[model samples]
Target: MRVGDIDISYDDQGDGLPVVLVHGHPFDRSMWAPQVARLAPRHRVITADLRGFGETTVVPGKTPLGVFADDLFGLLDRLGVERAVWCGLSMGGQIVMEAHRARPERVRGLILADTFPEAETPAGRAARHAAAERVLREGMGPYADEVLDKMISPTNVRALPDVAAHVLRMMRGTSPEGAAAAWRGRAERPDYLDSLSRATVPALVVVGEEDKFTPVDVARRMHATIPGSTLAVIPGAAHLPNLERPAEFTDAVERFLATVA
Candidate 1:
């Protein structure tokens, strides 16, 4: 669908209460295949490729979380989804929080998976800038290779052969400009703890037990702050728990959705 200055790629499946699944940095909507397949049985599942990732147009310039949230809203409005369950992973999770902050009434519930609400630290900001410069100058393959194990546990990378390969494919396919744009966008994100604390709806915060980036401690803090959000840690998985432990991840999500009504 064409939204704003870019064309957003999305997959809308099944039929019931709408549930929007947003993917994280550098990856596309395909990351939610497991969740989409499982949730579609009981609810409408919409997976979208945000700007600069997947089949979406890789427009240059900063894509702020607010802009991402607005784009999501535009997609939902076009689809006639007045209010729906929002499930976001990594950067997508931050977008979900931003969308809720902008228009809480449009969200029925939230599923923040493998994500955190904190702003980038001084060093983190510098590192992101450096990464962006490198990716833009050279390519994304090197960074993807270096971060594969960090994205998912080394044990899972060896145990589930396809997951790592899939991540590599996604990372390699990403537009360097898009990747840089997103990295810069995320670097500027503000802390959402205060806003998340005021949430009135149900939320499920899922994290990987072995996640190095956003560890279990981050998940616990988000759980404690996000009103009545449930926290579930997928044992032996890392940042991308959904891909690393699909069955367990699906169960955790299903458990949360069951309590929504």
Candidate 2:
């Protein structure tokens, strides 16, 4: 689909209410294959590749979360979808939150996985810019090597070899320029926690029990803030719980969605 000047590659299947799945930074829509396959049987599942990632061509510039949200809203508009349940992980979750903040009427519910709403702290802002510079100087190899192990829990390294390799491939294949752009853009993202009370829609917060990035505490905090959000932690999984524990993640989402509409 053509979203503004860029072409967004997406998979839209099934026949119920729209449920859009957005992948994290440096990753593509394929990360949601597990959830897509399962959700396709029950609802209108849409998985999209964000700019600079997946098949989407990179447009050089600072791509803010608001811009990403606009692209998402545009994608849905082109598809004739009025509203959808926004499901996102990590960076994608931030996009969903921003999109909801910008256009609350367009979001039916939220499925935030391994994500948080706090803006980057002073040290984090510096690190993100430095990381972007490092990636540009050394390419994605160093960054990929550093994050691969941290992306998944130690237990998953042995138990889920395929999962580990999957993330590695995604990271390695990601466009360095795009990844750097996202990292820089994230450094400028605003904190969404303060106004979260205004988001009255049903939400499901899923995080890996062993997630080093967002962890269980952040998930609990998010659940407590969102009006009536449910929380589910996938045991032994790390950052990408949906990929590591698809069945459990899908089960959690299904139960939550069943209650909403």
Candidate 3:
């Protein structure tokens, strides 16, 4: 259905408590395939492609975290869901946090994976803008080729060829305009640490042991900040742990859901 000017693309499956899965940048709803398969049996799984990615309408300008959050809630509203557990990875995680901030009453729980709440630094902001421009100019093929190893560890990339290929495919398939818009929006995202620290809802923080982008240290800091959050570290994965170490990642979510859902 259309949410504002964009037509959001989503898959809703199974029955039970609602669980919305948000995919990270340069990716789409397909990234949540493993989680949706496992969780749908026990919970309602809703996964959507953010604007400019996958099948969603591509708007060529800035798409802030708040706009992403609003789009998600608009989908939920149409589905008749009042509240649900919000789960996200990387940039998606930040969008989830933004959702909670925007409508705390609508978020039942939070599952933040391989992400941080810190605001972008001066250098980081500049780098993101530059990267956005580069993506616009050079396109996603080169960007996908460049970040494949960083998205998944080199060892895993070799050991799990299918997983590596899927990651690359998602990145390569993403719209350059959408990716660039997300980058610009992400650069101006506010620090979520304060809101997360004050959050009363249950949270689970998961990180891949081999993830260089958002390392275990960053996950630990996020865990410490959240009053009663659980921390799970997947041993043999990197940024995209759900695909690299599917069993471990799903197990963590299953365990966390038992308590909250």
Per-model TM-score versus the true fold: 0.98, 0.97, 0.99
Model 2: per-residue Cα lDDT over 1-261, one tens digit each: 788989998889998978999899789999998988888888999988898888997876567888888998999999999999999999999999998888899999999999989988989889988887887788877788788767887778778999888888888888878888888889898988866777889999999998989989999999899898889989878898888889999999999888877
- Which candidate tops TM-score? 3
TM match of model 3 to true structure: 0.99
lDDT of 1 by residue, 160-220 (tens): 9999899889999999999999888888989999889999999999999999989999999
Which runs of model 1 end up more than 4 angstroms from their true locations?
none
State the weakest 10-residue window (summed lDDT) of model 1. Answer: 59-68
Clashing pairs counted in every model = 0, 0, 0
Per lDDT, the best of the predicted structures is 3
TM-score of 1: 0.98
Model 3 is weakest, by summed lDDT over 10 consecutive residues, at: 1-10
Worst 10 residues of 2 by lDDT: 57-66
Ranking by TM-score: 3, 1, 2
Candidate 2: count the clashes.
0
Q: lDDT winner between 2 and 3, please give it.
A: 3
Superior by TM-score: candidate 1 or candidate 2: 1
CA shift at 114, candidate 3, in angstroms?
0.4
For all candidates in order, the CA lDDT equals 0.91, 0.88, 0.93
